[model samples]
Target: MGLLDLFIASTIPVLKVLLITALGTFLALDRVDILREDARKHVNNVVFYVFNPALVASKLAETVTYESIVKLWFMPLNILITFIIGSILGWILVQFTRPPPHIRGLIVGCCAAGNLGNMFLIMIPAVCKEKGSPFGAPDVCQSYGLAYVSFSMAIGAIYLWSYVYNIVRASAAGTTIESTRLITGQSSRESSTAELGSCTEPLLPSKEPLASEHRIDQYALPRTKQIEMEDSGNKQLLSKLLGNINWKTVFAPSTTGAIVGFMIGLIPYIRKILIGGDAPLHVIQDTASLLGDGAIPTLTLILGGNLLKGLEGSGMQKSIIVGIMVARYIALPIIGIFIVKVRLGFIPADPLYQFVLLLQFAVPPAMNMGVITQLFGAGETECSVIMLWAYALASISLTLWSTLFMFLI
Candidate 1:
């Protein structure tokens, strides 16, 4: 295909996203008032808890199989590399930009998580349908592309929930603490007092011990006892670390759906029953697919509604936005190309698959970041601002990168 054809193919999907997003923005206008704050929140909840899980489950069940899983193992590694490298870049950007405490996680998340699912779902098939497309015959390309995209979506959900979700959660907690300090001016003192209050026993021991008292001093121990105490302390430290992790977020609805989908896909008996036209249980799959189809358009609309907030001035620094764009669009794509080229020996030789891998690194941040910021009430407006710019530039950046990626492959 010509460079112009590739550019056109790539740009079309982004343009569709933009148009739907614009409609969302319009619906959120004061006069329209259809997708205002409360409405948006309710819609967001449905998308998060319902539409998203259905999409992930249905798509994975349809595409993933034991053989495909083995063949596509490297794609997961590639996705992980994108997140790792993007996170490193985000951290560097955070240090340089020093955004407000609340937005630090938002910035890091926007950098690390790409629109791995939706963008590819749109772009891959569109590219395949292009005349003289480089990947393969359109029918075969479409089938494999869907599988690749579906697998990418499942893996990306895992990383996004476990890694990015917690980062944003931590940032939200820090922002809350910082805000408390600013308001009360005694947050530290109160924390210390709370800690001290937990130890209610008297500093000086009484002559008579209470009925519940063990009458043994914890501090007075033999050398061996001290070693045991140290081991206990280590266990406590490990427990604290584990407790800090948000298991709920780690096994978020989307992640749960992915796991369930994998089970359905990998177990031949289950797959035979659930996935094909001749399956006895195909109705379940059909229903899930119906719900899944709504995920992207709804997400895009929510994205547009959120972007409306940016118009009111989010107080985010221009430099921070620029940094995120540079990391995701400029720095990450270059790094992805290099990574793919270097690992060519291990990577699947299919140019189409290679294109999907490279594209993962090139797309804008996941639309779910807006949902996340809103969920935690941290930097929602600022997230909108960043997304506005990131997506606005995506049209041009994605076109150029898609052209280059195809040309190189």
Candidate 2:
């Protein structure tokens, strides 16, 4: 199919994906407000360790035949390292501007990691199949995608876990209280010497104290926390970077799942149960396909939601929407081009590598980002706006971007 045709095909799915996702999230929120918060965290844990990583390893195993393992591993390492570099570079650039730390983390994560596995996997392979690449067969697109997705999955999980853990830890520390007064009180009292922290100052005198001998009782007075003190910017950025560094936490489920799955794929004994025969891996393959379809679109809608919410606005809030539009189109893509061309010189203009790079540049901001933000107790409304904008704007951005690259480069 022609490039224009590919654009029409790939982007249309985004709308359905976006809308259903938004609807599901709202429904989920309205039904269970408090429980949803707890559920979201556990869900993140499940996706990171089990559902998501299994999806990656299984997809790779499917694509990585005897001949393709070397490039399968090596080519993706190139993309992973390049993406890391891009993430750091973008981090430094945004840091100088001194935006909120959560916003900074949002940009860094989106720039570094992406929705390639979920969003592009379905679309790009079909496009490649239609075009009939010289690599070997049309399946090269899917194979190529395996490597790309692995790189993304590895880093995306790491980044997400890190981002989330930090915020959660901080939030817990900030809000946790050891005890609260309750009914059937045993009448224990706080030591008078110990000052109780107040969220706000003591109530102002109802009547002006005009009389001599008027007494003001000293009580726990509320003090307004300065914005600077209340600001969690640096803490947010650090949590985003450092929260999930433990090796055991990062790799336990992924490693266990991978080992079991791979053993099933490799061994004749286990293969019988999963696939019914060693000759054909039908059972495992079908199961893999089921996870594959649900994972990406679910993930895409999440991206749409986050992008919808995250963009917030300019400092003054005037022209804020305009600023957001510029950030999505003018700023990010421009930087993406500079990184590909001037910053990191393309070693070779290989079509596959080019496609991978462009795909990274184009993924909309993700819902996972908003999840991370909420977990961290960071800028919610702003994250929501920006994420939504990025998600909503991705179709136009990707279409125009691909068009420009086709003509200009």
Candidate 3:
């Protein structure tokens, strides 16, 4: 397809999201009050706990088979690479910009987690159905595209919860400690306490260092007993690490649904029960799919509501916003193209697959991060501000990169 045709084709889906998001903004206005604070919170709850999980589970169960997963093995690796590179960039931005401790996580998260789910789920099928689409046979293209999107959503959710969750949580904790110090009028000790309370250090056995006398006494123990003590210490360390992990955060409702969906899709008996027209439990899939269908619009509305804060932001820097735009929109897509081209031997030659992979690099940050920040009660305004600029820029960035991706792939 020609570049202009591709750009037009790519932009249609984004425009749809923008329209819905605009409605959200309008509803959130004081005059309308339809999507006011209480309403937005309730809607966010449904999306996070119910709608997202249903969407992920239904789509994944319908599309992902063992064979398909095997063929698509490189996708998970590609997503991991995005997070790794984005994180490195985020760290660099943090060091250079010197943002407050609480907002550092928001910056890293914006870089690391792209809006991999809703945007792709919307854009891919729309692109597939377009007359000028480069991917062949609309029906086949959509089926494969949905499968790619499902995988992207599931895997991205897993990484976001396990990795980015902790980053934001730590930031939240630090913010709380600093706030407590300020409230209690501990002006002089606040800096030292904030440093002490920072979550940068791993949860360790003790913060206190062993005295030289204690070290000398430990060396006086029998060699055999010392070895045994060291082994026991290692075991305890492993156990402590395991215990410290917040399993509830890691296995969010969406992640749990993904696991269930993978089980249903991969196992023959389960797939027979839940999938296909003839399945006895097909009604369940239909119901879930119906609910899942709500995810994109609801999410976009929340995105709009969140963007309302961007207009009256919490005094975020223009530099940080510019850095995120450059990293996510400019640098990441170049890296994605390079990786896909270099690894062509392993990556499927399907144009849709290649396009989705490249598009993954170009989309905005996940809207779910707003919900996460809300849940933690920290950085909500800052997160909103960052998302507003990133998504605003996404309209142009996604279109331009989509055109380039279509031509390259």
Best by TM-score: 1
lDDT of 3 at 327: 92
How do all models score by TM-score? 0.91, 0.59, 0.89
**Steric clash count of candidate 3:** 0
The local distance difference test score of model 1 is 0.90
Which 10-residue window of candidate 2 scores lowest in summed lDDT?
A: 176-185
Kindly provide the TM-score of model 2 when superposed on the true structure, using C-alpha atoms: 0.59
RMSD of candidate 2 to the truth, in angstroms, is 12.8
Q: Which regions of candidate 3 fall more than 4 Å away from where they truly are?
A: 181-236
List model 2 lDDT by residue over 126-177, tens digit each: 4455442322466665667565555455444554454433433443333333
Best by lDDT: 1
lDDT of candidates 1 onward, in order: 0.90, 0.52, 0.89
Clashes of 2: 26
Ranking by TM-score: 1, 3, 2
Candidates sorted on lDDT, descending? 1, 3, 2
Per-residue lDDT over 131-226 for candidate 1, one digit per residue giving the tens place of the 0 to 100 score: 768888999999999999999999999999889999999999998987787888777789889989998898787887665676354545688678
Q: Write the per-residue lDDT of candidate 3 for residues 108-176, one digit (tens) a residue.
A: 998999988999988998898987999999999998889999999999988888889888998888888
